[model samples]
Target: MKKVIMGNHAVSYGVRASEAKVISAYPITPQTHIVELLSEMCANGEIDAKFIKVESEHSAMAACVGASAAGSRAFTATSSQGLLLMHEMLHWAVGARLPIVLANVNRAVGPPWSIWTDQNDSLSQRDVGWLQIYCESNQEVQDTIPQAFKIAEQLQMPVMIVMDAFFLSHTFEIVDIIEKEQVREFLPPYEPEIKIDTADQHSFGNLAGPDHYMELRYMIQEAMDRGLDVIKKVNKEFEEIFGRGYGLIEPYRCDDAETILVTSGTVSSTTRAVIDELRDEGVKVGSLKIRVFRPFPTEEVFEVLSKAKKVAVIDRNISFGAHGIFYQEIKSALYGRTDIPILGYIAGLGGRDVTPKVIREIADKAIGDEQPERYINWIGVKI
Candidate 1:
């Protein structure tokens, strides 16, 4: 079934389809709608689940950790400051090997205080051990939600589904919403190996001594490494059932592209439009949308950019003094490969427009062999 929906609503549908047994979250801008819908569903008996409206994001994640530990499928969501508040429990969620799913609506961090879009919020938690999936459209948000559960539970690791603030979060689009029966056939109920309970009154998240700590960390790495395959398998199943397939990185017209654009989140949509517009003008350019950011698909990126004559990376977040966050990663991914010229362009902070014109301008620069002087060059900004 297809319906016109907001990104947050699409996410809510995904949650319902996943049959999440527990949902705990705080009310934060852009992120509040997701929980609101879930709350309505829970109250209306549309979903058989527990909706815990915690006072703070920290408690929200804590509740999810508790629910997941109790062998229930749990989910939660938060934005910039909210995610920052839950920083500590992030380690607890992954370290305890709980398969929790969180929706992080990306927002700009504040010194001057801004609630609009930026990647810094979620990217700031890149080291927190959660598998992060950056979404480009409401459709991807809907699709990735169920897929995230499978990935998280299979790996026994928590995952973050990152959608840009205001863009994917608040934007409306017609999405091919999956059927409930189809979703049921695809993602069955979650049953864990061990859960927090009275019969098995075993301690969870207990402090591991030097004797067993190293092995636990190693197991996490092993699970994450194996997650790549599991994710693909789940996506294949999703495509078979839903008729749509997604990947860690989605390549657009890269087969014979001379200049390539690398992007994530909603900007990829604008880049796609630019690619089509440029193609009609006889320009050999393409685009790549990177959906999965955490398990940073390095080898796959190299495989895509290997043939391009030049590459341009557009990012919505900065790494302070370094470079555009995704740009730095893409450059590192292609390091030592002398085939293509790569340029990094930073754009659209505070929810500014990353329009097709801006994308075409970037393509023009790369096409003309112009290089960015700095790693964090702003686009669509007045000089």
Candidate 2:
């Protein structure tokens, strides 16, 4: 059924469709509505689930961890500092191999205080072993929840569904809401091989000694290594059933393009418009939206980008001293494979608007410069 809803409610509907058994979250700006609606659904019997209201984001995730450990489909939502508070439990979810799904509205981390969109919060948890999917629209955001659950259960790893704060979270759009009946066709009930059971008890996340610790960590890496294929398989199955498929990396008009812009989240939509405008004027530029961040999609990214003359990455999140997070990943992916000039542009930090003019400027620079003057470039910064 089609319904006009904001991104947060879209997430709630996704969780509803996924039939998550345990929904636990602490209210945080931009992300609160996601769980708020789920709470309502639970209360009204629209969803047969337990909506656990917790005090802090830490406790929210801890509650999810406990629920997921008990072999239930678990979920939660948070943004910015709320996400940061859940850092410890996030690692716990990954290390324990519990298939808990989290919807993280991408908000900028605060010092001076801001509730706007950015990738820093989720990016900061990059190495924690969660499969991260960044959504471009409310429809994708809603669809990804069930997909994330399927992917997580199959891999026995947690998944994070990330969306831009306010941009995708507060903004209303028409989404073809995937009903629970349809989702059940694609994502089956999660049945884990081993779970915390009282009758047939098994030790989970027990202390790992020096002899076995390395191997445990090795297995985690192994799962990550296999994540891409599993995600692709799940995506294909979802597309077959739902008639919509979002690949790991979506390359638009890239077959014969000279320059390609890399982006994620809501920025990808704006970048696509810029690409079309530039294309009409005879500029051979394309855009690549990275839907999946973890598992990196190195081979797929390389294949699409190697054909381009220049590549520019527009990052909404930066890694302090190093460079843009996606920029680093893109460069690493294409490092030895191709020496094409891959430029990195840090723009739209702290919810600043990444307008077409800004994207156009980056594209023009990338296309105009035979060799980029610097690896890292900042856009729309005041002195």
Candidate 3:
């Protein structure tokens, strides 16, 4: 059914469609609507799931870990500090090899106390071994949930579906709500060979001696390596069923372009508008929206970026003292493959509006021969 829904509720609907057996989350700004709707669904019997009202975000994730270990399809949502609070447990979920899916409404971290949209919160958890997929719209956010479950359970790794805070979370959009019956075709019930079964009981996350710990870590990496192909396959099957699909990375009009804008999340929509405007002005430009972050689409990124003469990455989050998070990943992806001057522009932090003009400025800077005065340029900063 087609419906105009907020991004948060869209995720809620996806969880419902997935037939998730356990949903536990502590509400945080711009992310509360997701769980709030889930709570109502539970209360109204719309979904056959247990909604655990946990005290803190930490406990929320812990509960999810416990439920997932018991072979339940677990899910949760959070933002900014809430995600940060779940840091240790984030590791717990990964180490335990549970297929819990988390929807993180990307928000800026605190110091000045901003609750607006940014990718820092989720990006900070990059190394925790969760498969991270950033969304460009409400539709994608909703759609990715069931796919996340399939991918997570397949690889025995948690998946984090991230979206901009207010930009996507609060904003409403028309989405084709995939019915549960159809979603079930794409995402089958998760029945892991290993679960907290009393009959076939075995210890999970038990003490591993140093001789075995390194190999276990290697196996996780091995799963991540397999996940790249699994993700593509799952997305392909999803499209076959739902008629909508998103690739690992979306490259727009880059075939004959001299420069490209690299972006993720809602900001990519604005970047697309800028691409068209520049094209009208006789400038060869394009945009690449990174829908998948973790299991970073290295080959796909290399293929698209190698064609462009120069690439400008617009990141809404910074790694602080290093580079824009996405920028670093892009460079790493392209390193040793091409000398296609991949530039970095840090914009939209703490929810600052990254208007089209800002994107234009970044594009102009990227195409020029001034050689980017610095590795990372702060776009739209007043100072």
Candidate 4:
């Protein structure tokens, strides 16, 4: 059915469609609606699942890890400081190879304390061994949740579906929620190929000797490496069933363009409008909405971006003493290739509005010939 739903509600619908057997979470602003809706569903018997209420985000994820280890499909949602609290268990969930799905409402990490949007929280945990999918729209948020579960379980890794804190999370949009029966047909039940069984009584998470430890880590790497193809396969099946196709990285108007803007999350929507306006004016500008951030998708990014005359990276998060977090990654990906110049535009932090006009200005600057000065250029800021 089609309805105007908030991103959080869309996520809850996806979780229901995915048929999560165990949902555990603590309430955090911008992300609270997700857990609240799930709780109500569980209370109303809309979903046949156990909604575990924990004290903190840390315990929420810890309990989820335990539930997942016990061979149940577990899930959680958090934002900002809440995500920071889940830091330790994030490693545990991945190290134990638990197929847990987490919906991360992206918010700026605080020192002065703010509750707006930024990608710093999730990007900070880039090495935590979870398959990270940055969402562009509420529809993607709803669609990717089920796919995240399938991909995570298939690879024995956790997955984090990231959406902007307020932009997509709280904003209402018309989304065609996938049907329950169809999702059930597409994503099978979660039965881990390798699991801890009471019948077997084997010790899990035992300290491996040097001989076995390195190999175990190597095995995890292999699983992540293979997840690229696995993600593609799952997306293909999802598209076939729902007639909505997606990729690890979605390219917008990249074909025959001399320059491309690389971004993720809700900002991609703004860039799309900017690109269309530029196209109508006979200016060749395009965009690449990076969905999968962890495995980095270096090959696909290179193939799509390397040939362009210039590439502008607009990031919501900045790494201290470096360029925009994603901009740096793009630079590293395109290193040693002198074909395309890389420009960094850091914008939309702490819930600042990144309008189409701002994106157009950035695109105009990117397509121009200027000596690259600062690695990080602040956009939408008063000089």
The candidate that wins on lDDT is 2
Q: What order do candidates take by lDDT, descending?
A: 2, 3, 4, 1
Per-residue accuracy of model 3 over 88-187 as CA lDDT, tens digit each? 9999998989999999999889988999988889999999999999998889988999999999999999999998888899999999998788887888
- Candidate 2 per-residue lDDT over residues 1-383, each given as its tens digit: 89999999999999999999998989899898998889999999989999889999999999999999999999999999999999999999988999999999999998969999999999999999999999999999998999999999998999999999999999999999999988889999888878889888998878889999889889889999999999999999999999998899999999999999999999999999999999999999999999999989999999999999899999999999999999999999998988798999999999999999999998988888765836578998896
Model 2: pairs clashing at backbone N, Cα or C within 3 Å: none
**Candidate 4, superposed: residue stretches over 4 Å from native:** none
What would the TM-scores of all predictions be? 0.96, 0.98, 0.98, 0.97
- For residues 158-188, what per-residue lDDT tens digits would candidate 4 score against the true structure? 9999999879999999999886688998899
User: What CA RMSD would you report for each candidate?
Assistant: 1.6, 0.9, 0.9, 1.3
lDDT of each: 0.88, 0.93, 0.92, 0.90
Deviation from native of the Cα of residue 187 in model 4, angstroms:
1.1
Q: Mind giving the per-residue lDDT tens digits that candidate 1 earns over 1-383?
A: 78999999989989988889999989999888999999999999988999988999999999999999999999998999999999999988989999999999999988768889999999989888899999988898988889999989989999999998888888899998865577888887888878887887888767889999999989988887887788889999999988888899999999999889999998898889889988999999899999888788888999999989888998888888888888888988988976477788888887778889888887887678555544456677788
| Count of clashes, each model | 0, 0, 0, 0
Q: In model 3, what lDDT does residue 242 have? A: 85
Model 4 residue 133 lDDT?
92
When 1 and 3 are scored with lDDT, the better candidate is 3
